[model samples]
Target: MHPVLFEVIGLPISPYGLLIALGMLTGIWVAKRRGRAIGIPEEAVYDTVFWGVLLGFVGARIAFVLVNFGAFLRDPLPLVFSREGFVFLGGFLAALPVIAVVLRRWRVRYLAMADLLAPSLALAHAFGRMGCFFAGCCYGGVCDRPWAVRFPRIIDWRRGPVDLAEAEFTPGGAIYHGVDRVGDVVGSPAFYDQVKHGQLDWSDTASLAVHPVQLYDVAIQLGLFALLSWMWWRRRTLHGQIFLLYLWLYAASRIVLELFRGDLERGLWFGGWVSTSQLISGGLIVVALGLTLQRRRLFAPASEPAAAPRDPGDA
Candidate 1:
């Protein structure tokens, strides 16, 4: 996982930031193409996208800061200036109003536009999660097994320093270091040697093994995108149905994935059993279901009497 892509002279460029920008560009291009194919005006799509991107960024930053208020208070400048963490739900919520207003101003049908944008959103998320992987921030829990990777750079203060030596050395008729036999390095020559070797250390309180939630999200979003595309192409018969389906599907997948995420600052309902995201996902599911039912009822066809074409005779 290369965080810094390269250095030009003394300046460093972060790969994560670059990948995010690339994702945005790809999303915009996809949306434009989809809009054109669907007979939506290119200018209208651009206008809506501009507003959506702005609001999305603002919403993502705000949500991240609010969730980690304690950390932000300690480092205000980084919280305000750095573009590290982002919450997709926050951005989606903020962009909803912007998209609605744009659609209203242009006299466009909100449901049709939503259908066009759904796939683009999912593709954008796929790339964003890939960026997270490269940045090495959203890492998984530790395991000694083969599939379990050791992030050498990840330090834990509680564990002190890990000694790779097979045995501990005793000092002057007393046992010193390696007493716990649980990778805890107390005062010992081996510990000092590890420090000299530049091995990273961190607090033992930190969870070492965690699920790689980012990859899980990427898979779910990509699947959703495929499903949405199929629905959009096949079922343009009913307006807003595709969008409703998208909301329901994504919310359900997100709720499932939230179970694997261990970084939420606030636990919901149960003691450390539920997360804030799960609660939000539940709300989204309910709203999506209601919308789906409402759309079905509203778009249902009703019989009407045929009218005689006697306009010419009347005239």
Candidate 2:
């Protein structure tokens, strides 16, 4: 795992931030093409996606802070400005109403637009998950399997745990010191957990082997993108069909995936029986199912008026 992909003239370039930006651009490109195909103006696509992504970032940040309020309260500014901690479900939820408003103002069918954006969202999410892998965040529980990954420990003076091998560290902070755990040591959320619980130690070079949940998410998102694209092209029967199916399938996948997550900071509720993402996924599944059924009934091709009621006497 490598957080800082490289340095440009002494400025470290973060793979997490880079990949997210790439995902955004890829998503916009996809949305534009799909929009044009479906008669949506190019400008409208740009405006809608731009505003949605901007507000989505704000929402994701807010949600992450709220879930980890205790930590933020203890130390505020650094975490607030940190590049990590955005939650995807929070961003998606925030963008929903904003996109709806944009479409309604334009007098466009919101459901149709949602369908157009669904596959793009999935594809972009796949890229984001790839970023998560490179950053070594959102890791999975320990595993002895052949495919389990070992993240090198890399904690920056101000950034806490980083994924860089040559990250410069200065002497600071009471808990972490520059000279304490030196060299190219493996580290990540998984590493933090293992070290905290005595499963691993600072003296060890790499983290305990763990499941590659980030890659699992990447696979799931890519598969969902393909499935939604197929539905849009061939199997769609309603305006909201593709998007609703996307919500349902992605939510279900998240629910299953959450079980393997090792990052407890993401949020755990009901005595840690469920995660915040899992809870959101449950709600989305219900909403998707209800909307799908309602749309099917209300928007199904109007049937020919059931043959004139009897008409035997008239005949």
Candidate 3:
């Protein structure tokens, strides 16, 4: 809920963008602090996170647009610049090589560096899913369950994604105030007092009470973050195992969670029986398992007993 946190000098700074920025900042800060403990310089951590995040953000947005090309093709300018839609997998994978190069250039152990940053990445991603909850993009299927929640005015029957054809925007080219907010820009908070909340009266035209998969995503991702943090504290996992475990656990959870997802813009295949993320997750699971088998050691003292000369899959 609460997509638009508040207007900043008449420009709406969406909760989506704000939470993403916060996730990036907090994630980098935590990674940097952790980096210092392991002999990585603060400046190096800063640079690594900066370039990785920059590339990740751009890649995620581009991946979203690429998957939903039809929508972007009609009138792509607004969505192209807007900091709304993103694909986590795209962002995560996109940054892997960049971070690897950064670690190599900075003379840091690549696998260990990935292990150090894994927890921070999970934590940041958990927050980003919460941002999706606020924005109501990655919504879930309709349900009659007691906890099912509604997102009000998530779509306007009269108007499609954006009425670029009509061209009813402000003098400065911003979206008008009273237009039927469409596409991802719609969606009001789930909880609203009928008698007290006037601005939230979009319930009259709201989307049906659904599974609230976004909130479900938040819970699962937080669990993923916790698992990574716990594994890190244990310090018994293999040098690259932490990141591999992240991939495994995340893939496992996502495979299940994607079943409850409702928004259809995300790429799908096999007659909608499988989402793109599910396919990738399935592939990553095998990758994680293979790495685990190859390592044959988890609690080894010297990081990796015998690391591959150059394993890009370490991440």
- Give each model a TM-score: 0.74, 0.84, 0.79
Candidate 2 local lDDT, 31-56, one digit each (tens)? 78766666777776787898899889
Candidate 1 residue lDDT tens string, 31-137: 78877665677777788888998999999878767766765665455556654667778888889998998877665677777877888788788888877765544
Error of 1 at 314 (Å): 38
Q: After superposing candidate 1 on the true structure, give the runs of residues whose Cα lies further than 4 Å from its correct spot.
A: 8-11, 141-146, 154-209, 264-269, 298-315
- The lDDT, on a scale of 0 to 1, for candidate 2 is 0.74
Q: What does the lDDT read for residue 121 in candidate 2?
A: 93
* lDDT of candidate 3 over 1-315, digit per residue (tens): 556666669766777788878887888888777766557767667878888888998888888788777657755764577557788888877888998878776667677777778888877887888888777677777679999987654333234222232232322332332112444344232322221124333324555677878778778777877887777767545667678788888899999999988666588899999998898889889988888787765434434432224445543
Worst 10 residues of 2 by lDDT: 300-309
Best by lDDT: 2
Model 3: weakest 10-residue lDDT segment is: 187-196
